[model samples]
Target: MLDWIFLFLTISLCLASRLLLSKLSNTSKKKQTLPPGPRYIPILSSILFLRRSLFDFEPILRSLHAKFGPVLTLRITSRPSIFIADRDLAHQALVQAGATFADRLTATEASRLLTSNRHNISSAPYGPLWRLLRRNLTAEILHPSRIKLFAPARRWVLDILVNNLKSKSETGDGVVVVMESFQYAMFCLLVFMCFGERLDEKTIRDIEAVQRHLLSSFVKFNVFAFLPKITKLVFRERWNSLLAIRQKQEEIFIPLIRARRDRKQQPGNGDGKNNSNRIFVYSYVDSLLGLQHPEDGGRKLSEGEIVSLCSEFLSGGTDTTATALQWILANLVKHQEIQAKLREEIEGVVGSEGEEIKEEDLQKMPYLKAVIMEGLRRHPPGHFVLPHTVREDVTLNGYLIPRGAAINFTVAEMGWDGKVWEQPMEFKPERFLAGGSGEGVDITGSREIKMMPFGVGRRICPGLGLAMLHLEYFVANLVREFEWKAVDGEAVDLSEKLEFTVVMKNPLRTRLVSRRKD
Candidate 1:
C-alpha cells in the first residue's frame, strides 16, 4: 500500500510539472506588444464569462475594445485569440490574410452530433473539398436559373401560410405559434431544396421532431466542449442520442438517393423511353452527384460526404432562416408604420391582379430592401460568427496572435456600434435608404466590414441571396394580407436568448388582423 501511494504521487507530480513547463514554454513566445486585454490565467483563460447573458458578450467585448483599441488578444484557454472590432483590421484579415485564417476542426461532440461537421461546407477546411462543395452549390443549385425553378416552392409555402393564418383567425383561439410554424415552413422549403421533391406533411413533421431533439442534445453538449478529452467520455448518452438522429436522417435520405440512382440506371431499350418521364432532379442532390474537385479530378462525392452535406444544408437553412424571419416579423409587429409602408410599396408596384410577385420585382423596392437591411443589422441572428482559427503566428495591431489559436468575432457588435449609427439602439430603416450611408454597404462584400450580418470574406454565408429573398417575399406578402399590431394587453418582448442564433427569449406574441379591408 505504501509503495503504491508513493508511485501514484510521483506520477501525478511529474504530469503536473510537465504541463506547467509546457505552458511556460508557450507563454515565453507570446509578444505582449499587441492591444491590451484581460490577463491570461493558467487555464480557463477567458471562458469564465462565456456563460454570461447573450447581450453581455458585446458590452464586455466593446469595453475591451474601448480600452485596447480595434484589436485585442483574448486567451480563451491558454490559447491566444485575436478579436478585431475595427473595420479596417477585419477587412485586412478577411480579404488580404484570408488564407491565413481557416476553420478550426469542429470539436468531437459537435461533429458526432450536428453531423454538420462531417464533410460539409461549414466543417470542411480551406482546401480542395471545400472548394468543390461550395462551387457545386453555387453553380448548380443557387444559380439564377436554379433559383428561378424554386419559385413554385415559394408560392406553395405562401399559399399554405395564408390558409393557415385564415384558419387561425376564424377559430379565434389566439394560437401561440412560437417559432415552430416559422421553423416548419423553413424546413419544408429547404427539405425540398435538398431532396428535389416535397415529402408528405407527415413526413416533414416526423423529421422535424427528430431534428429538434437532436439539436437540443447537441447544444447541451457543446457548452462543455472545451473541456479535456476525458470529460467527453461522461457524455455517452448525448452521443448515443446524436447517433440515433444520424440514423434517422440517413434512413429518410438514403431511399431518395437510391431511387434517383436506380432511375438513372434503368434500361431504356436504347430509345431513351423513360428519360422524359422520370422525375427531374432540381435540388442539391443533383449537384452532389456531379461534383468534382477542380484541381484533383476526383470521383463524385461518397455517400457519407453527401449525407453530411445534405444535413448541413438542411440544418443551416432551416434554423438560421427561421430565426431571422421571426426576428424580422417581430420588428414589423413592434413597429406598424414600417409594416404599412412596406405593404403600400408592394401594392403600388405589383398591384393585386392575382399574380404571384416574381423574384425580379424584389429589386424594384428600395425601401423594403432598406427595412430588411436594418432588421439584419439591428438584430443579427448570429451574434458570434462561427469561431475561426489562426493558422500561423501573425501580428495584428502589433500584438502576436500565435498559431493554432481559435478566434471568435462579434458580428452584432459591428452592426450596433454607436459610432457608426445615430441612435444605434432604435430600429430605423431610413438610415439604410437611397441617400443614407448604408446604401453602398453590401453585406456580401469584404471591402470594409461596416456590418457583417452574413459574415465577411471567403467564409461568408453563401446562402445570403436566398435568405434575403425569403425575408422579402414573406414580409411583403404577409404585410399585404395582414395588419400586425401588438396585443392590447400583451407587448412584444424584444429580449434575446442564444442558441445557434440570438433568438427572442419570449417570442413576439401579437394580433394579426386581416388588412383586406383595413
Candidate 2:
C-alpha cells in the first residue's frame, strides 16, 4: 500500500512539469510574432521547399510572397529569413530604419573563406571598417576623375573587341559566339585597373579561369552555407574543393600585390616628384596598401585582405558588366526598329564620322540612356541583393523582426512591379523618356523606389557612376561601329540561365557587319 502511494505521487509530479513547459512555450511564441510562412517541420523546416539549386529558388520565393503577402518568414534550418517583396517596405527598412537593418548576415564557412573573414565591401558588416574601405575606393579609384584616367584602357579594350569581332565574323559563317570575346574584353579592362599593368592575354585568361571556376562553385555549396559545421564533416570533398580554390586565388593575387608594393616602395615612386603624373594614376591596390584601420589601432590590411579586395574588384566589375552588355546588345538585335532609332540618335548627336563615342557625348543622347535603363529593369544581373541582417529586434509593418534575422529584398520583382510600371513585361524604353510615366525615376530609390538596379540607401553600389559610364560608352560604340543583325538560321534567344550572374542560356549568336570601313 505504501509503494502504490509513492507511484501516484511520481505520476502527478511529471504531469505538472509537462504543463508548465507547455505554458512557457506558448508565451514565447505569442511574444514574438513571426510573419506567416509555410508550416515548419522538424530539422528540415522550410528548406524542403527549395530546389536542388539556389539560383532557381527566386520563383519559389515569389510564389510564397503571393500566398503569404509581401513579408513572410522562411525557416531554412534553424535560421528564419524574412523576405521583403514590397518596394515601400524595402525603402522603409533599408533607408528610414537603415541602421537597425544595416548589418550584414553571418557569412557561411565558404563565404568567410572566400571573403577573408568578411573583409570585402559587399560582405563587410555595417561599421567603421566598411566606411573606410568604401570611402577609399570612391575617392581614390572609382571617382569620376579617376575613371577618366582609365579612358585609354577602355579605348584599348574596345579596339581589341572590334578587331576580334570583325575577324570572327569574316572567318565564321556570319554567326559568332560573342560572349567569350565580351567576357575577355571586360576582364582586360578591370585587370588593367586592378593591377596597374597591362597583363598579357595568357595571364588574363588564367586569372579569369580561376575566378570563374570559384564563382561557379559558390552556388553549388548552398547546403554547406547553412549547415557549415556538420557539413564540413559530411561533405568533406566539397569543403576541400573550396579550400583549393582559395589557395589558387592566393597564389595568383599575391604576386600581383607584391609587384605593386615593390614598385611603390622604390625610392622615386614614394616621393611623388619624378613620377608625379604616374603616381596620380593610382590603382585600387595602391589605395588598399596605404589604408590604416582606425578600429584596429592603425593596423594595416593583411595579405589575405588585399587578395580578397582585389578579387572583389576584378570579379565585381567584369562578370556583371559583361552579362549586362550581352543582354543590351541582344535586345538591340531583337528589336531592329529600336536599334535603328538608337543608331539614328547616336549619329545625330555624334555624327557617323567614324569617330569613337566620347563619354561627354553620352549626356546628349536620352534614347541611349533609356535603352540601357530598360535593359537593366528587364534583366537585372542579380535577382536578389546580398542578404542583410537586423542589428536589433525591430518592428516592420507591425510584425516583429527579431534581432539576427536575415532579410533580403527582391531586386527583379521591384523592377517588374506592374502596379508601378505600365506593361512591365514589354521592352519599352519610351517609358523612361521625359513625358513618360517613369520619367525622372531614381535608380537609387532614395526619394522613391521606381526601380533599383544598383540598390539604394547607405549600401548603394559605389561603382554606380562608373558602371553607368561603361554601359553607355560600350553600347553606343558597339551600335555605331556595327549593325547587329540576327542570324537567318539562328535567332537570338532571350532565355536566361543562372550563373554568378543571370546569363543567356544559349549565349548570343549574331551577325556583325561594320557600318563604316574605317
Candidate 3:
C-alpha cells in the first residue's frame, strides 16, 4: 500500500511540472505579438504555399493581403518573412526608418555565386563598398552629363530597332513578334555602354542566350539556397547544369573585361586624356577599373567583381527596360485614344513625324511622362523588391517585427491600391496630368505613401534616372516612327507572365506602319 502511494505522488508531480511549463510557454508567446499570417504546417512551414517559381507568388500574395491585413507574416523555410502591402507602412519602414530597412537580406547561393559574393552594388550589404560602387556608377557613368553623351548611342540603336521592325513587318503577314527586337535593341545599347564597342549580332545573340538561360534557371537554383547540402547530394545533375551556365557567363564576360583592362593599361587612355572627348568613349568597365574600395584598404576590384558588375549593368539596363517598353507599347496599342493623346503631346513638343525627338524634348512632354507612370503603376517589374532584413527589433502598426526577419514591400499592390488611385485597374494617364488626382505626385514615396514603382528612399534604384530617360526617349521615338496597331483578328492581350520581369503572356504581336515613307 505504501509503495502504491509513493508512485501516485510521483506521477502527480510530473504532471504538475508539465502544466507549469506549458503555462510559461503560452505566456511568453502571448507577450510577443507577431504579425497575422496563415496557419503553417509543421516542418514544411510555408513551402507548400509557395509555387515552384517565386514570381508566381504575386497573385497569391495579393489574395493573402485581401484575406489578412496589409502587414502579414509568411514563414518561408525557417525564417518568418514579413510582407508589407500598405504604402504608409512601406514608407514608415523603408523611408522614415531607412537604416533599419536598408541592409539587403543574406543573398541566396545563386545570387552569391552570380554576384561574386556580394561584390556588386545591387546585392551588396549597405555599406562603404556599396556606396563607393554606386557613386562610381552615378558620378561617372549614369550622371546627366554622362547620359547626354550616350545620345548618339541611343540614336544608333533606335535606327537599328526601327530597321529590324520594318524588316519583320515586310516579311511577316503584317504582324511581328516585337519582344525579340526590343530585347535585342536594349542589349545592344547596354553592351555598347559596357564595352565601348559595337559587338556583332552573333556575339550579342550569344550573350543574350546565356543571360536568359541563367535568369530562367534562377528559380531552380533557389532550392540550393534553402538546402545547399541536401540539394547538392540529391540533385547533382541540376547543380552541375547551373555551374555550366555560370561557366558560360564567365566565358563571355571575362574576355571583355580583360580587353577593357588591357586598353586602360595602354598609354593614350590614361587620366591625362580630356574628359570631354572621353565622355562618350568611356565604358562602364573603365569606371569600375578605377574604383578603389576604402573599406578594403584601397584594393582594386577583381576580375570576378568586374564581371558581376558588368553583368548586372547589362541585365538591369536591358531586361527590365525592355520589358517595361513592351508593356508601355502594348498599353498604347490597346488604348488607341491614349496613344493618339501621347503622340499629340510628343508632336506638340518635338514637332512632326520627320523630326527627331531629342532627350531635352522629353522634359516638355508631361502626358508622355504620365503614360509611362501609369504603365509602371499598373505593371511593376518585380512584385517585390529584393528581400530586406530588419536590423533590430521594431514595432510596426502595433505588431512586433523581430530582428533578422526578411521583409518585402509589395510594390505592385501599393501601386494598385484603390484607396490611393481611383479606378486603379483602368489605364488612365489623365490621373497623373496637371490638376488630376495624381498631379505633382512623387514616384519616390518621401512625403506620403503613394505609387513607388521604382521604390523610394536611399535604397531606391540607382538607375532610376537612366531608366526614365530610356523609357521616355524610346516610347516617343517609337510612337513618332510607327503607328502601332493591333493586327486584324488579333487583339492586344495584356495578360502578364512572370519572368525575370513581368512580361506579356502573349507577347505583343502588332502591325507597325512607318509614319514617314523612306
Candidate 4:
C-alpha cells in the first residue's frame, strides 16, 4: 500500500510540473509582441530587480528606457508591470487616459489599518463617490475663500515656527534647525485646522510621535502594505503595531470629531462663553462629514474614516512642504549669490526693516518665486507621488498595459532629465525666471509638465497655493534674518538620502550670520 501511494505522489508531481511549464510557454509567446524588457525568471523578479532604490528609481528606469525603448514591462512576483518615463506616453496614460489609470495600491488591508476604511478622496475608486468627495474638497474646504478664512490658523502656526526657530538660534549650540522641526510645527497647525481649537501641544505631540514611530517601522508596515493577503500570517507584528497606532490615533481624533459634531448640533446657550455661533471655515473634515457612501447610501464617515482623512492632511502638508523648505534653504546656502539676489529683492520690496512679512508682499517678489520654483524642481519631496495604477486595459507607445498593473512615473528623473533642461544638475533659479532655455517649462499643472513636484494630471495637489505660501514666506524671512553660510568652513554636503521625503544624508548644518543691516 505504501509503495502504491508513493507512485501516485510521483505521478501527481510530474503532472503539476508539466502544467506550470505549459503556462510559461504561453505567457512567453504573448510577451513577444509586447514591449521588450529583461527576460522573466520565476519568483526572483521581486528579489533581484523589482525592488528599486525608492529615491533613485528614476535613473534605473531611464537606463532601462535606454536599453529598451520608452514603454517596458517588468515582472513583480510573475505579474507584468508597466513604467512610463517618456513625456508624451506619460501624458497619454495620466491625462488623456485619466480614469483608466486609478491608484494601484492593492493593500485594502493596509488602507483599512491606516484609514479605518474611510472613503478618502485618495483611496476612493474612479466613480461617483470619488467625484463627490473631490468636488466637496475642492468647492468647500480647499476653495480660495475657505483657505483665506483659515488665515488666523496659518498666522498662528507661522508665529510658532518663527519664534521657536529664533529662540533656538539664540541659545542652543549654534542654532541648528532640524528640517523635521518645521514639519512638526506645520503638523501641529494642520492638526488644529482639522480637529478645531481642541488638542493641547502635548496631546498633539503624542499623536505626532506615534505617526513618526509608525513611519520608522515603514518597511515592516509596507511588507504588509504590498502583500495584504499574507499580512496576517507573515507580518502579524507590524500589522498589529499599525492597528495599535490607529487605535491610539482614534483616542485623540475621535473626541475632537465628536465634539465638533456635538457643538454643531447642540443649541447655543445664552452665555457667550458657550458660544456655538462660530462660522465654519469649511475644513477637510467638514467636507467629509457631508459625504454619503454611495454604495449603500450609508451615513457620513465613522471615526476611523475621519482619522485617515485627517492623517492625509497632516502627513501630506508636513513632510512635503517642510522638506521642500529645507532643500530651498540648503540651495540658498550653497548658492550665496542667488541668496543675496533673493534678499535684495525681498528687502527692496518690503524694506530691510519690517515688522513682519505679509502674504500680499510675496507676490511682488518674482526672484523669490523663481527660487522656490527652482527648489521644487531640484528636490521634489515625494520622489514618486504615490504610485498611480492602471485601472483598465490601455496601450502606450504600441505596448499594452493591462488593468491592475502598478505604474510609476519618474518625477525626479523628469526634473533632472538633460533632454528637458541644459545644466540640469546646476542650481540655477534663473532657469525659471522670465527668459531662459526653460522659459517655456510649465511648473503649473494646467499644462502637460516637464517636471512634476506636486504630481501631474487630475490628481495634482490642491494645496499648491498654501504650500507656496509656506515656502516663500518662511524662506524669505530666514534669508532676511540671517546670512546663511555653510558653517563658516564646512561644506554643505548635497548628498541625497530617502526617508518619508528626500533629506540630506548629512543634514544641512550652516552658521547663521546676523543680516541685521541696522
Clashes counted in candidate 1 amount to 1
lDDT of 1: 0.72
Residue pairs in collision within model 3: none
Write down the TM-score of every candidate.
Answer: 0.88, 0.92, 0.91, 0.88
Model 2 clash number: 0
Rank the models by TM-score, top first.
2, 3, 4, 1
lDDT tens digits, residue span 448-494, model 2: 88778888788888888888899999999999999999999667788
Better of 1 and 3 by TM-score: 3
lDDT scores in order: 0.72, 0.84, 0.83, 0.71
Candidate 3 TM-score versus the reference: 0.91
Candidate 3 weakest lDDT stretch, 10 residues: 42-51
| Candidate 1 deviant stretches above 4 angstroms | 1-19, 23-35, 42-59, 106-109, 112-117, 175-178, 223-229, 264-279, 292-299, 352-354
The CA root-mean-square deviation of candidate 3, after full C-alpha superposition on the true structure, stands at 7.8
Candidate 4 per-residue lDDT, tens place, 167-278, comes to 6667766746557568877887777767656468888888788777766566555444333454455546657777788788788777877876765454452232245565
Best by lDDT: 2
On the 0 to 100 scale, the lDDT of residue 475 in model 2 is 94
Q: Which sections of candidate 2 miss by over 4 Å?
A: 1-29, 43-51, 267-280
RMSD list, candidates in order: 4.6, 7.2, 7.8, 5.3
Report the Cα lDDT for residue 169, model 4.
65
